[model samples]
Target: MRPRSLDEFAGQEHVVGEGSVLRRALDAGEVPSLILWGPPGSGKTTLAQLLSAQVGAAFEPVSATSAGVADLRRAVERARVRSRSSDTRTVLFIDEIHRFNKTQQDAVLPQVENGVVTLIGATTENPSFEVNSALLSRSRVVRLEALGDMQISALLDRALADTDRGLGSRAVELEDAARRRLIELSGGDARVALNALELAVMATSDTNGSARVGPEDIEGALQQPALLYDRAGDQHYWLISAFIKSVRDSDPDAAVYWLARMLEAGEDPMFVARRMVILAAEDVGIADPQALAVAVAAQQAAHFVGMPEGYLPLTEAALYLAVAPKSNSALRAYAAARADVAATLNQPVPLHLRNAVTSMERAMQFGAGYRYAHDQEGGLIEQQHLPDGLTGRRYYEPTDHGAEAAIADRLRAMRGVSPRVSYRDTPRPMIGSKRPRGQAFGDRTLHFEPHVPLIGGRRPNTSRSCGAGSPIPR
Candidate 1:
């Protein structure tokens, strides 16, 4: 069978073809140590083969699941011998590279640095966490996207008409119905489509060798065992991606479902909790500031109490996060400030804000003109804290998605910040007796999910439940 080259490489036109990143790199004849990141059947391994073939580099391949440090050492040794003998570097291709732990991954660094081999690692998992940071830095990551429906259909069309590798002019025939079924079942995986088509043909063939392929003949073929990861494998990370997206999407029920998936996968409860903690701070920032506290507390409590028992805290945390008024304003604030610091690393800190922690330091004109907020009874001292040239720059703009409505007003009044608040300055509270006037205490707050089943299953009195029809169970 003829191997597919760059000219024949289907899909990912963004990265391949003339004037593209890969094309340019291949033309240069020495591409960076690369990590191809994508879903299965997105041609990660194929790309590796293509890379080696195009560049005239001998490819040495290893499977991460089966290859140990010993196997790695031998590959390294072989590469060394080949490089010295041919005076040409080899491409050490490692598939499922995330399976290699830190120590094994560390061994490849020196080889990569020495140019004895160009490390071409393939992993479905995000390299930032799975691959060692140093090794990742040495490689340029190329992300492959799942083929769209159009691409999948086009591939199927080619398979149906091509007589060589594909089953064109075969004893079996593929109807449009059969084609649609094949494409749908492939889940954008090319290997899956080819394998399924092959299976359906075999199933339809008679003892005398006459066969016909149709929707009926391929029904069982649809259920054929996967050619790829049987269990979730690294694809389980994709579930976490879905979960994070759901949480970000703000559908509590959907978030709960993703949590259930991660939990069932035996994903570390603490790790899940940690992400929740991060999400609470990163996604549900000052708009629902209490969520970060709740998430962090749940993580600590779950850790301290230790599982089965720990699940309650986790569940509660998820629920709180799901229902919390979501905001990324605080996250944006920090990011903006960090960007400013990075852009102006050499800019001097204004003198007034500098520490007067020592008398000698104080004598060096430190803390000369600082205004203390505490000195004012209201804790409302108006003073500039930014660099002299960078004053009145607004970094945090609050959205009224949740608690931010009130926060939007308060900060607007306090800092002269003009915010595009999405909701009214004062939204009616759930426990609305006009919000019990004067100095609200933080203690004894009532909270509940709107769609959650009422406590003890009691539908409230129609007229007496505070002008509300249903007494939502707390």
Candidate 2:
């Protein structure tokens, strides 16, 4: 049975409850063009109906799947006739409005804009992506949540007791456990709960006067309720979202369960594998360097082995990723670098770091004085590598998780030069030309003096060319 009034509406107190924006609008008879957004059987259509009736508008309902431009025009024409006869305007309720393509949706715009009808669109899909921007800008989106167990139970109770529209006329007795089973199978859907209840009542044979419906009878009626999944539709995205979140949150059990659900629901194994690979890099990252390797191997394994058997590698990878030490440092570092590039495009490379592949480049002081890092004592060098403006720009900030701890330590040791060169402690860029006297960049040393002692002994005054092709000044 459907709720006749806002008071009777079981859930969605956020939108239809007392003092809510929609409720306030309804009270004043100033219902704007609106979109009712929610999951299936969450009463999006019913809400639209209630809103139109409350505002005393002539309700003209149309299914977007079946109705085309001509049908829309006819509905508008009927509304015009209704307006002429009475003071009441029309409420054009478009069910599954998301199903309407951009061109089809645009066709209804003129009618809605002209106040010929107050458009009320109901959609299980997200309205932002599905509904046209022009239409969205003119409407208010009211999101409805899936009903909870308590709400579903209440609806079931109402169905069992309501005489007029419900199965109150039948000689049926619904047991407590049977009621719980119906609620579980409904998945917080009122329509589903009522339908399952009806099936259970109709199938049960009457014992003397009343037919007692047990959990077994309810289970039989439900017969493994089809999971709310469509491989190419909204549920696909929703399940993947949940799966990703579960892994990110480090819940191995949830990660495995969602993985199984997607596989069982005919989701592409390759798609799942791709997502795992991305998650490994984006979420687990260098904290667990093995995660990316595992994910990639899983993808290869799945492709090689094929379905049914392919699930083994996929599940193993998902579980491994879920338990790995988490770090988004690599992802964040890339984001920061991208922002910098966007902000300051085409920054020139430092002279010493530039390649001098040609003689012309060498003459221009390109690759002027870069030293060979391996020739140095500790395989450490002090050199200007980053573009001039980004001398001390620090992008990669490693967290002390898994293998990243050693990376963080090494970075601290290498980047640590002067007391002023503490890039790790302070996030600001080093602006001035003050270079650390004996600081090492990788392995080579930046010796301004003509003759600095070499690792073993100083070489004789011979013409020695650096890696950058700069001749040592004699």
Local accuracy of candidate 1 as per-residue lDDT tens digits, 324-408: 7778877766665565554445556788899889999899989998988767644555567777644555557677877786665
Write one digit per residue (lDDT tens) for candidate 2, span 320-344.
Answer: 9999999998887777666556555
Model 2 residue 172 distance off true place after TM-score fit, in angstroms: 1.0
Best candidate (score: TM-score) = 2
lDDT of each: 0.73, 0.81
Q: Number of clashing residue pairs in every model?
A: 1, 9
Instruction: Give the root-mean-square deviation of each candidate in angstroms.
Output: 14.1, 8.3
**Model 2 clash tally, residue pairs:** 9
TM-score, prediction 1: 0.56
Question: Lowest lDDT 10-mer window, candidate 2?
Answer: 436-445
